[model samples]
Target: MSLSFTSPNKTIFIYDSTKTSEVALLQHVKDQTSKLTEVPINITSVTPQLLNSILTRMEPGTSSLLINKTSPWYRCFCEDFSEMNDFILKKTFVKFPSLIQTPIVIHQDEVYVNPSMKHIFDIYEEIYV
Candidate 1:
């Protein structure tokens, strides 16, 4: 028999197909959290408004780091917006959500962009303890 657990708080997972590494990271987060914590994660496709909201919560320069420079989508974005000021870059994400990196994890008011295992643990502790 198998045992399962669920979280009381809503966990929003935003992912994109362009980021292969993020996909694996997202899976690892789910598995680790399932085993170590009671946080139930819900995976969802990202939206433009959602991207805008996440960026709004972050510092100007910090949010831009979430852009996946190696992805083909980024190549085109760089070509088009060669010199992206903070405002323009944030606006662009609101227009084209796919241009940003994934998988973003949003737990309540906190948001994690391209989360690591350490990041997941930190958030879990913040919420649970």
Candidate 2:
């Protein structure tokens, strides 16, 4: 399945909850992406296609960084599973999208999984300027 954009805007944000410690940062990214792109950012939960796109396009390190290792969901998976790879993880995400991390930002051809403000800002500047 292919990921479809609801809007013509080129950015997509896969965020979990607003209650996270990164709420402020996520808001900042939303505001900036909106202002700079002149279109609302596409905020969504992790859908199957979205997860597939992320698994295929994003680097393994960045994708792994987004996972909440301490979450009960993850802990349980780790307890039962010994070997882990991108393929297995992708399947897991397909089943439990909520278990995946949040604030996954995607722009034109760039995918930032749980990135820092500096990284987002850099991309924004490069694209908008």
Candidate 3:
């Protein structure tokens, strides 16, 4: 049997699929965090190629983007709202729209996140420390 070592560090690209503040805050957080210490999070463009690369690199320990609260991404940005929703739903990277509205936790092939902050902390503590 191969002795497996887990890589807790991961590249979390806060991809901005649309042109909005969501991109900025995520980018800002990443930038500020960069100055302090190594952050597992990274902000990047959410275009087709970038998103694909992000998923490709995902592994054991990973953190998804915690989009800024006011980000217009929760709803369709373009005039074609219905079509946009359909497109987002169809994509493998964004299959679950629920994750967009609410924070989601995925680990070991599982997805979970509670609405409360403390509960979220518990989950993070279990994963990181």
Candidate 4:
């Protein structure tokens, strides 16, 4: 049950709505994508399938990039997991979505994790403008 983007022009925004920063970023993405008449953006929460898709796109040894280091679950149990592999991290993220980073934007083959406004602008220009 992996997530796939069939349309090359489409953008996918995976985020945690509970986080204020992510919510703000989502609004910014919405504002930017709205200007594009054709390219559509899919905004969604981080599901297991979506998370796996994101993990696959990310570079090796960077699997923990999506984990929220500030999360309580992470702080409490992070040390316990001496062997924190992708599978364990995925399970942990599934159990605690709040423990995963927010506002990951996927545009074509590129996956932006917690992207800044500048990154969004660059993506817009590259894809739309």
What's the TM-score of each model vs. the native? 0.58, 0.67, 0.30, 0.78
When summed lDDT is taken over every stretch of 10 residues in candidate 4, the lowest stretch is 35-44
**Model 2 alpha-carbon drift over 4 Å, by segment:** 6-9, 35-45, 60-63, 79-82, 85-87
Q: Is candidate 3 or candidate 4 better by TM-score?
A: 4
Question: What is the lDDT, from 0 to 100, of the residue 55 in candidate 1?
Answer: 68
Root mean square deviation (Cα) for candidate 1: 7.5
Q: What TM-score does prediction 2 earn?
A: 0.67
Which residue pairs show collisions in model 2?
none
Tens-digit per-residue lDDT, 59-117, candidate 4: 78776677677777777767855588778877777777767765677776677777887
Can you give the lDDT of residue 66 in candidate 2? 54
Model 3, range 59-104, lDDT digits (tens) per residue? 4233233223343454443333334432353262343332332233
Q: Give a tens-digit lDDT track for model 1, residues 6-121.
A: 23365656666445675666676666554322212123334444456666656656766678675556777876565787667767765556566666676655667778767777
lDDT of 4: 0.66
Local distance difference test, per candidate?
0.58, 0.59, 0.34, 0.66
Could you tell me the TM-score of candidate 4?
0.78
Pairwise TM-score winner, candidates 2 and 4: 4
- The lDDT, on a scale of 0 to 1, for candidate 2 is 0.59
